[model samples]
Target: MCSRYVGFILLVWFPGALHAQSAARHCPAPALVGGYFVPVKETYSHDFQLTYACENTYKPAVEGWWATSVCQDGTWSHTPQCIDEKGCFPPTIANGKYTHASDGWYEEESVIRITCDKGYEHKNNLATAKCANGTWSSLPTCEQSIKTCSMPPKVPHAVIVHQGYLELFPEDSKVHYECKDGYRMEGSDKNPIVCLAGTWTEYPTCSKVTVRGDHTSTERGTQPGSGGGGGSRPDSGHVSVEVGTGRGHSTSSGPGTQPGSGGYPSTSDTRPIMIPIKDCGTWPLVPNGVVVVQDRMFLKFTCNAFYTQVGPEDVVCYNDGSWSQIPICKDAFCVMVPGYYTYGLRLSENQFIKEGELTYIPCEWNDYSVAVRCTDRRITHTSCCRSYDHQWKRCSIVRENFLPVGSLIKK
Candidate 1:
């Protein structure tokens, strides 16, 4: 009976001792690159966990800046590492792909070219992107390209000059128009309507012409006859005649006879006639302009600062109840051409300069600049020279003299 009890106790004690030995087993401190671990020790027992953090510009290989690992059975559950944070992942773009196939990470300042799929183009016409310090610059987006414009709107009393059977017009295409008979174009005949992107510019208008002599007036008169029945034949005397102007006619009537015996010619007689005159209402509105003179039969218009009058400045109202001609105000700003530079400053393309304003254009010589003025949509004074004294030499001179730099070009 004593031997059996000793064997049972030995079996339970052996199992407990094995468990303690296993628990005492330890793992060496893990080595991390570009990082350090917290609560560091020479060795760690089983189930012991340690936290690690990476240095600046470096990230843990696991997930975040900090990570954890455990010592299990004399071995670490995970090996910690820190990698460069200045690298970028592959960019995912819709309706676009990289010009060159690349699957690896992109380093800082690396450029990548992108190509949009068919029927699409890069936004703002940009086709490349650069990785800047772990983050990519603004990437170009794929958008549907506008290549053509639909049929242009029709203008009253005007027809397209040379339009063919085609329905769509390519971008930047221009179409001319001609006014029909009895009508005149209100805008400039040289400037044609243009197609821009997917739309057409404003079409020109044709105004009708009012013909003269459409209204008329008439008057009646009578000459004396040889008969003498003065007092009694006052109502029936003389030959009456009628005359008219503008679409009127003439008429005549025979003389009257006396009551007793032979008839006698009557005295002259005259009758007054009245006619209504045609009147034109208020003056027509002028865009970008104002009416300087407004009268019952006359009107005058003046354009704004940057606009020009396209027609006559004054108009007259005729007897047909219509004005002679209505004027329009057109844009008169100067457009900056390519390679336009002035006074050490480079002007942007298509820059608008208002009328009556001055612009200094750079000359062939670095020290010289040409003074040009915008007048009625035209650039005046295109000559340039190194000095005002040498203005006549080495430059295409104009009739008008150039203004001094101090007068126009401000510092």
Candidate 2:
């Protein structure tokens, strides 16, 4: 309808032997000669080169319409291109390849430039080439970029600080042990040191307490000769002591039990017990309170060895029931608070509590009360009364509960 121009853009690409390949004078056919007039031009960069005036396939024997892009500035031609179905050149990208080829004869390398897939490095290179008399050249592009290991911290016990390596196992590296104060802790506290390299798979121990009477503390052991303690005492009741020594003959009453002194065992036909015993002495039948009874019941009167086992020798008869309750064997044994031993339970007679067990005793609740038999030691809030003589067995002169009037007397 409105022809802009069209010389001949028919590269019908081989066929129809009709030589008239001459036409580039701005569309000549269409004044009404036959039927081939195609003129569509937006002016070079104005892009629109599809000129076809029945030339054939690049069809357009040369009639009208042709001038895609390339003619701005000094505009003489070049930049018009269109060749799709794989002619291998500007078949895409705004489609336009045919800057007046044989039509006006204006050519530079023609046109061809396309590079996108292959690791794609986009920058600028959509080339074009048509220099066989046309002209178009400039294409080149290729791009790829992204590169990780960071871990190290925390080396306490076993000293295992991975990634950067710090391992200290059976003995390869790392070692520095130290722990003392009643001894605390066992193995692998990380780098606690010791297995510097050879034979210290794990070492940390000091838990020590020899067990003579009662003791406990544990962290671990086995260093010097290692550890050792073998004890056995049960010959009926144990008296086999090795300390002050005093067995058989004397059971307890007060002074020198003879042999090596320290006696408190007097069995007069078995009489005489005013309660005064130091070591051990006089006994064969001498007993005011020595019951080794067995049947009045099968008997389990167990007091469980205390005077420090040896044999039944000290006075004899012990497997577990030695003198059973004989307390007064004092040489030295008081402040001991573990489980309770010495006078363990008998809170009567001469007031013995070497740390006995009235349930671990610390009782103050309501502030002082349970005071059974007391004498002159003065200390009372709710209770405190004493009066035992049973026949002058002695020990009973204490009354300090509500005393204030002349403060009582009669020691």
lDDT of all predictions: 0.56, 0.26
Q: Assess every candidate by TM-score.
A: 0.24, 0.13
lDDT of 1 by residue, 24-117 (tens): 6798988777889889789988889989999998876555668898888888776666656876656888879985424346767777878887
Best by TM-score: 1
Expressed as tens digits, the lDDT of each residue in 1-411 for candidate 2 is 123222232335332434332222232122312223245333333222333222222311222233222223334234233322122222222222223334333233344334443223222112333333222222223221000001112221222322234321322334454444444444435434332211222333333334445756451332111122111112233233111112323332223324423222223223222221111111222111122433321222212111222223223322111222332321111211123112222232122221222211212221111223213322221221121111112323232333231112111
Backbone clash pairs for candidate 1 read: 225-265, 226-265, 227-264, 227-265, 228-264
Give me the runs in candidate 2 sitting further than 4 Å from their true place. 1-56, 59-86, 91-411
Report the C-alpha displacement of residue 22, candidate 1, in angstroms: 27
User: How many backbone clashes are present in model 1?
Assistant: 5
Worst 10 residues of 2 by lDDT: 144-153
